[model samples]
Target: MIIDFFSAGFDVFSSPLALILTFTGIIVGLVVGAMPGLGPLMGIILLLPVAIGLPAVAAMGFLIAIFVGGSCGGSISAILLRIPGTPLAAATLYDGYPLAQKGRASDAIGIAITSSAIGGLIGGIVLVFALPS
Candidate 1:
């Protein structure tokens, strides 16, 4: 029962359209999220018009990807400018700024992004496996 639901949800990715949209959404999210004051929600809202024409699965995939990417994107600004792109990146600003000042801006950004990705992966796993049962 639960397994079937999970499988059905994963099945949406079988479509190439969903993959492409998701990828594009991530890029768009990264760009939008790097801008100060524009977080994941705003990125989704701004892009909703475009998503309107997409199929349901693709739209959801795109929006979800945007959210994930946006959440990580704020770290870019935090690392580069010492200013958090969003409140979610506030913690990043502390360590990220120091690294940036040390001529390791690239390294700081990489670490921030990688850590965010890993955190998201772990959170997703916990939600899917631990929380369900």
Candidate 2:
């Protein structure tokens, strides 16, 4: 049953428009999230009108991509500027800023992004495998 759902999702995402909108949403979210005071929620709010016009699957993919990208984007500012682009990024500023101060801004940003990706992947895996009965 879950496999069927997964297969259906793959079929839906095979659409070019869905792929394009998802990538665009990620880019837009990254830009918006990098700015201090703008988080993933803000990114979603800003792009809600655009999402509203999209088809159901495409809109969902776009919004989810935006959230994923935005979640990672905040660390860019947190590391480089010692400022949290979002509240969730506040913790990043601690170690990330120190690394940046030590002349490893790129490394810090890389680590931040990699960690965020790993965390997201683990969380996603957990969500998928641990669905409620």
Candidate 3:
């Protein structure tokens, strides 16, 4: 059963269209999320109509990418401008602002991206393994 799940996931991700849409969604989400008053929910909602026209697997991939991108995007503004782009990024302003003041904005952004990726990976793994138990 676990193997089947992995196989299905791989198959879905192997689609070129899915990959392209996911990347585009991520870019769009990042842009939207970096703007104040916008967040992942809004980003996803805005793209919902486009997703509705896509295949199930591709749509899921695209939406998930948007969600992940948006979650991280807010930190960009928080770090660079000392303004929280989203409510979720408010906490980041503490360290992010300090880092930016020190001329380490790039470092802060890198750290944010890396941490987000790691956290997402762990979450995905946990969800996958926990689902069967």
Candidate 4:
């Protein structure tokens, strides 16, 4: 029963439509997060009406992807422009700007991306374990 439950969850996420929607959400989140005065809340709120029409699982996946992308996107501006695109990224400027000044901007961005992926994996694991069956 537990195996079946896990497999069913994986099947939903592996679907073509879910993948497409997740990608779209991530792009939208990244764009919003990279812009000054824009953030995930605004992005999600703006798209909430559209998300409402989707299936429950897809809607959750889409919104969650947006959140993940937005969280990571702020680092882009911080590293390249020395300006934190969102408040969440403000601390990133400390290291990101210094790296950019040293002509290692690519390295900074790469580290940020890698860190985000690790964090996302951890978050996913926690979510899976924490959710009530």
Question: In candidate 2, what residue range of length 10 has the lowest lDDT sum?
Answer: 25-34
Q: What's the TM for model 1?
A: 0.92
Candidate 2 residue pairs in clash (backbone atoms < 3 Å) = none
Tell me the spans in candidate 4 whose CA falls farther than 4 Å from its real position.
Answer: 130-133
Give me candidate 2's TM-score against the actual structure: 0.93
Off by over 4 Å in 3: none
Best by TM-score: 3
Ranking by lDDT: 1, 2, 3, 4
Candidate 4 — what's its lDDT? 0.88
Report the alpha-carbon TM-score of model 3 versus the true structure: 0.94
Candidate with the larger TM-score of 2 and 4: 2
Clashes of 1: 0
Full-model lDDT for every candidate: 0.90, 0.89, 0.89, 0.88
Give the local distance difference test score of model 2: 0.89
TM-score of each: 0.92, 0.93, 0.94, 0.88
Residue 92, candidate 1: how far off, in angstroms?
Answer: 0.6
| Candidate 4 lDDT tens digits, 1-133 | 7689889999978888888999999998888888878888888898999999998888988998888888888889998898887888898899999999999999998998899899889987999789887
**For model 2, how does the per-residue alpha-carbon lDDT over 34-70 read when each residue is reduced to its tens digit?**
8998889999998899999999999999999999889
Clashing pairs in 1: none
| Ten contiguous residues with the weakest lDDT in model 1 | 124-133
Best by lDDT: 1
